[model samples]
Target: MSSTDPDVDHALAYPEPPASPLWHRQGAKARPLTDAQKQRNCELLLLAQHKPRTHRRAEKPACSPT
Candidate 1:
């Protein structure tokens, strides 16, 4: 069959690619967090909540002395 032929079956022409590695795969099941990890996460969340917010001041142009 001609490579340029429009009637050629492209799907059957090429070999299937190898499957992706386990680490590269997405949407895999996540393991449940340990008790220590859960407690640390809660402590971090509380600390973050109690942290003060900072406000930035507007920049002023330099004044030239006469």
Candidate 2:
């Protein structure tokens, strides 16, 4: 067998590579969250957008007679 070929395994004749960290792995699964927790997070984010979602803005502000 020729070792100069690109497909040839040179590590088998030497040694294997070192292991990588957990973050480096691409197949890790994330933990699931409760429905209530998810909703709370979403609501808090929406509140930051400053939209007119409160009852105080249901009607337009009274304009002064000019």
Candidate 3:
């Protein structure tokens, strides 16, 4: 009847379930990027880095009692 009984703990314990079938699946292998693709990626990265960010301001409620 003791709470620390090992037999009670083992009776209530359950084994861990197996992982999903997708867990062991492998997707299509990726191909290496071409030189032109690499250059284009670099240019796009630079443009994104230097792009100006605009801040949005909250406007007053349209229908307020005067």
What TM-score, computed on C-alpha atoms, does each candidate reach? Answer: 0.37, 0.33, 0.40
Clashing pairs in 1: none
Residue-level lDDT tens digits of model 1 in 29-63? 79988877776666555555553743433243232
The Cα error of candidate 2 at residue 31, in Å, is 0.7
If the candidates were sorted by their TM-score against the true structure, best first, what order would they fall in? 3, 1, 2
Evaluated at residue 52, the lDDT of candidate 3 is 75
Q: How many residue pairs in model 2 have overlapping backbones?
A: 0
- lDDT accuracy of residue 44 in candidate 1: 55
Model 2 lDDT tens row, 18-51: 8767547567567787776676565555555546
Which number leads on TM-score?
A: 3
Positional deviation of 28 in candidate 3, in angstroms?
A: 2.5
Overall lDDT per candidate, in order of appearance: 0.57, 0.55, 0.56
Let me know the TM-score candidate 3 reaches against the reference structure.
0.40
- Which ranges in model 1 have alpha carbons more than 4 Å from their true place? 1-27, 53-66
**How well does candidate 2 score on lDDT at residue 19?**
70
Worst 10 residues of 3 by lDDT: 57-66
Q: Which residue ranges in model 2 land beyond 4 Å of their true spot?
A: 1-28, 51-66
